[model samples]
Target: MTYDLLIIGGGINGCAIAREAALHGLKVLLVERDDLAAHTSSASTKLIHGGLRYLEFYDFKLVAEALRERERLVKAAPHIIWPMRFVLPHGNAVRPWWMVRLGLYLYDFLGGKMTLARSRGLRSSDAAYTAPLKGGHKGFVYSDAFVDDARLTVLNAMDAAANGADVLVGIAVESARREDGVWRATLSDWRTVEARAIVNAAGPWVHEMLGSLGVNAASNVRLVKGSHIVVPKLYEGDHAYILQQPDRRIVFAIPYQGGTEIGTTDVPVERPEDAQIDDGEIAYLCEAANRHFTKQIAPGDVTSTWSGVRPLYDDGASEAKEVTRDYVLELDTNGPALLSIFGGKITTARHLAEEALGKLAAPLGFRAHPVTRARVFPGGAITDFPTFLTQVRQTWPFLGEKRAERMARAYGSMLAEMLAGVQSEADLGSDLGGGLTELEARWLHDREWARSPDDALMRRSKVGLHLTPAEHDRFSQHWAALFG
Candidate 1:
């Protein structure tokens, strides 16, 4: 079949592009080598933020773009994206309080009209904000939004499919060449397809994908690995903390699930697969947390870890941490058409999609008015998530408060469709542990293209983290029997 656009990659950028193109009345086909968000998209710091530290580098344009997208995403997906407050302590500070305050003022100003609260000072006597600190230090509190990064990618793909796009997983374009005013491509599954234009949103494999097509762009991708570790809960609050390391780098302590997730060391790596955390990364993260929280943590306290390679556009920055988070779209129209995406963060992916499609409109000879701006994602339609969540708990008491909340957040308004005629415990199917029911698992597989249980557990949901070792193994085995 000949398609209007063939998007190669299922990460946020690729999925978002597919969504935009499909919504514009184009025949879109998005193919991913693995499950959606199986890599960097699932391994984010998991925040829809404007990167307050970017102010230090005077990246006003990028910050403003990110902040605008942040508010839009929060309003669109309130269930998966919750407004979170982050505390930045002044003690043992890298940047002075005056400088930090000034930067935050710029941040708020760049954000323009926003529904989120503005930054403020935190006094030492404010125990709720200072109780977890080593010295009960005075600090600053600011607002940003937290996100479920993986589900964001999945929902985009679901939306694309709903709009008549063909979303394929575990498939790749093995080889391709532009011919007869179209790109003829062969898939890993041994099928040939044609498209008027191609998007190399292969992310970390951007350069490699170009090499495979025997094409070249003026830009290159630099792989930087960012790692995070999850430890037992650090404090009693819904808020998160932004800690300053002596290296002038920043680390975040966000309350996640039942643990305090701390992260993100900036280390340059040679390849995309170098996603494993070394002993030094673990030690650095543990020490970063120990320097602030009264409830200290050691490497042994870490319950889980995740790592992802940022495919940053090489800007010749001397240090890895100084690399730009802003994206660059390289459009090479030598033959049919090719657009390669590089260096983007999750917070601005939706905007990036709009920009990407706009860049391709003239080259691909297609244009339809943008519909993604006002369109809420598949399950993100309700006005008030908390109120809707309370209604969910009251309507389906069988799901228990926690499970109901989890489903409500992951699927939002779509949760009701997933539960359709379910009334009692037995109607929902077998309890597969980790709050996963057989019905929900089937829904993820049949509807969401969850090929494996791990896709449902790790990406679409973090249910794997809640499952005990035995339950995890048993559930995987059961899934293999049923779906494999």
Candidate 2:
């Protein structure tokens, strides 16, 4: 089919751009080789904030843009995105206490007007902040956000589909070229289509896609692999910790799936499939955790791990950590319109989309305004989460407190539709094990494009993390029985 825009990739950037373009009245078709956010988008440390460490490098513009977007995104999807506190202990080994305090001050200032609290210095003896730490070192408490990154991407794609854009997963744009004032593309399944423009938002495959399109830009991408390990719950608090490493790197310990998630060792890689955690990375993450945590952990203590290849814009930085986290949009208009995106984080995907559309819309003779900037996601209607959660529990007491809270956060205002006409547990169909009911699974499959068990278990919802081995098998059997 012919369209206004053909987007390649289903990561956060591609999905967000599709949503933005669809909102702007563009007939858009977005194709993904795999599921949405099956790569770098799902592999983030899952924080939506002004990068505190980025301030150390004096990247003020990036920090400011990210902070503003952070505020807007939380408002847009309070169900999946909300304010989270970060406790950064002052250890003078890497950065001096004064430097961190000064950075936090600038961070607070850069955030401009915000709904979250401002950063503050905490006394070393504050039990609430330092209860689980081995050392009573003073620290700073600051505001950022935690996001269901995969769900955020899915929601954006969902909204795009609702707004009249075509989103196809498990499909690939195998080849494309500009001709006759339009761009023609060949899909993996032998389908052909034409569009006024084509966008390359392929995360790790951006560079590769450009080669097939036969246009070279001045900039290239540097592949950096980041890995994280999930272990038993480290401490009992909603707040996460920012541990400064002796090598001038920082590691975060975030709470996830009834466990603590320690992450992200940046190592340069040659290929996208290099997205596998090495023993060295595992040991490094474990050691990083052992350094500050009162509970010591080893390799065996790790429950699971994940790795993603960050296709960062090549700035020629020698160190992986020093590479820019900012995104670059390259527009090639020699024949038809072509735009390629590089090096973006989940926090600023929407902002990146806005910028991408601004670059492409003018050249393609399209007229549209930025309506998504003020708009919230389909399920993001409530102003406060706790109060909305209480309302959810009250309405669906049969789901119980934990199930109600989980469904509320995952579906938000959409939960009502998901549970429409359900009066009792039996109405939800069978409890397919794992917090998934046959009805809920059907809703996800029909509405959210959950084609496989992993799509339902992992990306669309993290119910997979909480499932037992037998429950996982049961989920797969039920999925086959229903949709096969």
TM, every model: 0.99, 0.98
Model 1 lDDT vs. the true structure? 0.91
What lDDT tens digits, residue by residue, belong to model 2 across residues 1-484? 7999999999999999999999998999999988999999999998898999898777899999999999998999999998989888765348777888889989999999999999888774567678777667588899999999899999999999999999898899888988888989999999999999999999889988998888897778999999999999999879999998888999999999889999889999999989999999999999998888888999999988889999999888999999999999999888888999989899889999998989997877876567788799979998898999999888889998788888999999999898889999889998877768999999989998889999999888788888888889988999999999
Candidate 1, pairs of clashing residues? none
Per-residue error at 127 for model 1, in Å? Answer: 1.2
Worst 10 residues of 1 by lDDT: 364-373
Task: Give per-residue CA lDDT, model 1, range 1-484, as digits (tens).
Answer: 9998999999999999999988888899999999999999999999999999887777899999999998899988888998999999987798887899999889999999999999989965678889889765577999999999999999899999999999999999898898998999999999999998999999899999998888978998889999999999999989999999999999999999899999998999999999889999999999998899888889998999999999999999999999999999999899888999999999989889999889888987777566888789989988999899999998899999889988999999998899989989889887776879899999999888899878989888789999888999998987887688
Clashes of 2: 0
lDDT of each: 0.91, 0.90
Off by over 4 Å in 2: none
Top model number, lDDT: 1
Against the true structure, candidate 2 reaches a TM-score of 0.98
Candidate maximizing TM-score: 1
